[model samples]
Target: MGTFTHGATEWDVACPRRPSRVAGLTMAGFRVRDLDPLRMVPHPAVTLLLEFGAGSTVLDCAAGRQERGSIVAGPGLGTGGAVRARGVNVECVQVRLSPVIARAVLGASPADLDGAAVPLGDLWGREASRLREQLGDVPSWQDRFALTEALLARRCAAGPPVDPEVAWAWHRIAVSRGLARVDGLAAEVGWSRKRLWSRFRSQLGLPPKSAVKLVRFDHAAHRLVAGEAAARVAADTGYADQSHLHRDVMAFTGATPVALAAEPFLAVDDLAWPGHGTPGRPHVPAGQRPVRGPESAQPPH
Candidate 1:
């Protein structure tokens, strides 16, 4: 069992395999406040979302798709690209998996996993309902950790091999780095930018650059709602400027930065980690960043 806590939220994680809890399946226990509507952008990682709320109308992010209503998956959900959820309340456990872990569990390519919300039993057999119910009784973070281990034990008994290196790199740069260029990252990983792009797309379902944008804006939205200055966040997260940040935020969230920042009903406690729940905006030191010309503020590779 591994644990990391921040204020009202805690990621109580566990795995069946030794030395690397992150290698196999893991679950994060989340408790957060309600939030204003925000967009779910694409990422380098595939996610299995299980909402314990009443219901949500998720906007299908692919081309030529429309928003559709989704239900609580007894076992949970599997899909890709950005999604949207409106009018959510406290309490939910979001289960996310690295591409390597997803491949090990599903025995299919990440691209094959893309689609609207599917039944958890469609993939997890009949134990889906039991698993969803287990979330309610979990008291300590350790219990959450143990639950994840037991669940993964059942799934991984027949799972495939997972590349620890690839999973680590994906979580580190694409998941943790937020929005940033991957050119330098490619060089550091000993893979050409083209090769990295191909692998990232195949394993995670989206390019690293796109994933970074999603997470960056996700973080930005939280901060903007928390009353952080748009200019400060834009510069800190590698956006070209305030306007550049505004456009991306609007594109991803369908709301202006100012409007998002001024939202009265939004709260950080309602968001799931690596998804939402970032406290007040991240404060980036002025001298610690690179300066860009007006022309450079636009989005680019």
Candidate 2:
């Protein structure tokens, strides 16, 4: 766990040392003593927030929707720049699920969420309450992680898996950091362009083109957060020019590149998600065995 003080609030954030037993899942823990509004940023993964704290965390959406307690947010949240969170004495376990495996683990299709955060209780019924109780009863962060993993493993086992073609296409997009062409993906998957677009959007909550743009934007955003110049980042990340990168940054975050570079949400990713994109995982071509582990896992929502 790392300790940091922002203004008057003290925060402790922890990431699990052990990778999740279930493929396509990653977990982190957070405890906050003072309340501060956390600016939620858009990412590619579906997020599950499980709270075991004494006080509930409140999520305010740009569309005027609000939610409290444990919640689940789908991919591309905060694209409208309306999503923010605040809590007092908050303790929670957050899981990021690959859209490929999200249906299995979350028991709902990502398309249903439409980039909104919903209370977990609404999706899982009593199970959400039970999970909070179970997590709160645990004494150590490892234990909480283990329990959460076990629950996800069980749910994944019982839920439906994504189509192998869809999974392969998603992996390709992720490995390429969203630079892969949709037409190339269609060819690789042996599906017609129309078919691939429809299926990808229906299953993953976004069309193939949107996925590429979002993934590419995420990569560029992080590079900016790492202090890279906009022009350099654009050149390296496949953006046509600095202005194109700026437009994308504004479209996704409603903030300039410089302002987004200093966002706490993106800054904390290094500490919260170390060894994020592990290398050495050979790329399996479309229709091959599905890749496993965090390398193939989706990004945070």
Candidate 3:
């Protein structure tokens, strides 16, 4: 366990002693005594929030919809800044599943989420409640992580996988930090543009271009949190200009780069996930961090 403090927000965060045996599966446990209302930032993985504690977890979503307890959201859950999270004495085990494996582990297509949060029960039925109970009963964070991984491995083993080409495209985008020329990737994989786009969206939840923008924004947003200048981040991450970067940030988060720089939601990632910004194992070559910086701003977001 470690303490992650960003501005006035603090959380007792835990990381598994080792990465999960399952590929694309990573777990982080968080216990926040007084979780302030934090804005949701877009991320490129399917997020599973399994809450278990004496207090409650609340998500305030767009159109005044609210969801409590466990939630599963597809990639870019907060596009247009539609979600906010707050809770008291909230303890949860958060899992980030790679899109390639999300369908298998989630037992539902990421496309169904459409980037919005849904109650876990809607997908997992009573097992969601049972899992919540089991998590609360667990004595240690490591135990909870092990239990969670076992469930994920079982589901992933039994569930269907995304097409190899689609998975390949997603990984290419990810390791390139969303700067990959997705347009060319289709040809590289011997698929036409239309076929690739439809398949990627149906299985993974978003179109290739949208995925690229979201991934790029995720990388740039974290750099902003790291106190890098907007202009510098833009240049480094493949935006046409600082204004372009600003627009992408505002589009995804509804916040200017300046305001997002101070957000604790992103700051916690540094401590919780640490070395990598996202939940899965590091995808970048050692020298390419920001956890895989893109090669150039070509096909700029």
Candidate 4:
């Protein structure tokens, strides 16, 4: 675990020692004290939070929904800047799932969540309670992570998987950091444009274009969090210019780039998800041919 202090708050965050066997899944453990209201910034992945401590945590969504206990939020949560999290002496495991694997691991498409933060009990039933107890009884963070990985691996194996083409398209978007063309993706996957759009939206929750923008913004936002100038980040991240970057940032976070740069959610990424900014290949099952995209083509800077 890595300990860091920001302002007057202290955080103990830990990442898994080894990468997860399930692709598109990452887990982190967080122990926080003297907590403040945290702005939940929009990101490209589905988020699952499993609370184990006795402290209380509340998620207030812009859509007028409030939830406690374990929570699952779909992609693009807090896009309207209304999602705020407040808690104290909180201890939990946070999991990030790529949209490609969310269906199988979560037992529902991201579309079902509809950009809302829902209690895990709603999705997992009594199993949610069982998981809470199991995780809380665990002795260490590594054990907790191992348990989570085993459960997710079992769920993914049993549930239905997204179409191979859909998985491939998502991987392409992620690897390109959201710069891949939809038409090109369709051609590469041997699916008509209409088919690809419908399938991708139905299975993964968001449409192809939206996925691209979200992934791209995620990349650019993290760069800003790292103290890079907006102008340089925009140039390197395929934005038309600084103004274009500003518009996208405003649309996604409802905050200016300057304001977002100081957000703690992004700040914690360094400790919770080291080497996470770069997109990696999605885990395709055995006997499946890996989909190829124009990964070698550099985006315009």
lDDT of 4 by residue, 8-113 (tens): 8989999899999887899899999766988899888889999986887889887577899899999889886889988987889999888878998889888999
Per-residue alpha-carbon lDDT of candidate 1 for residues 16-96, written as tens digits (9 for 90 to 100): 233224442435544334433444533324455544434343434445444432222211121232345544343445454
Candidate 2 segments whose C-alpha is farther than 4 A from its true place: 277-301
Residues 1-301 of candidate 2: C-alpha lDDT, one tens digit per residue? 9865665777788988877767678888989866588778798888999999587799988757789999998889889567889988889998888888788888889999998999999889999999999999999998999999999989988987777667777887888888887787766666678987888888788888888888888888888989999999999999999999999998888889998998877877777777662211223223434333324533221
User: Which pairs, if any, clash in model 2?
Assistant: 62-82
Model 4 TM-score on a 0 to 1 scale: 0.93
Task: Return whichever of 1 and 3 wins on TM-score.
Answer: 3
| TM-score for all models, in order of appearance | 0.59, 0.91, 0.92, 0.93
Candidate 3, overall lDDT?
0.85
Each model's lDDT comes to: 0.49, 0.81, 0.85, 0.85
Reference-based TM-score, model 1? 0.59
Instruction: Report RMSD for candidate 2.
Output: 5.2
Q: Return the lDDT, model 3, position 65.
A: 97
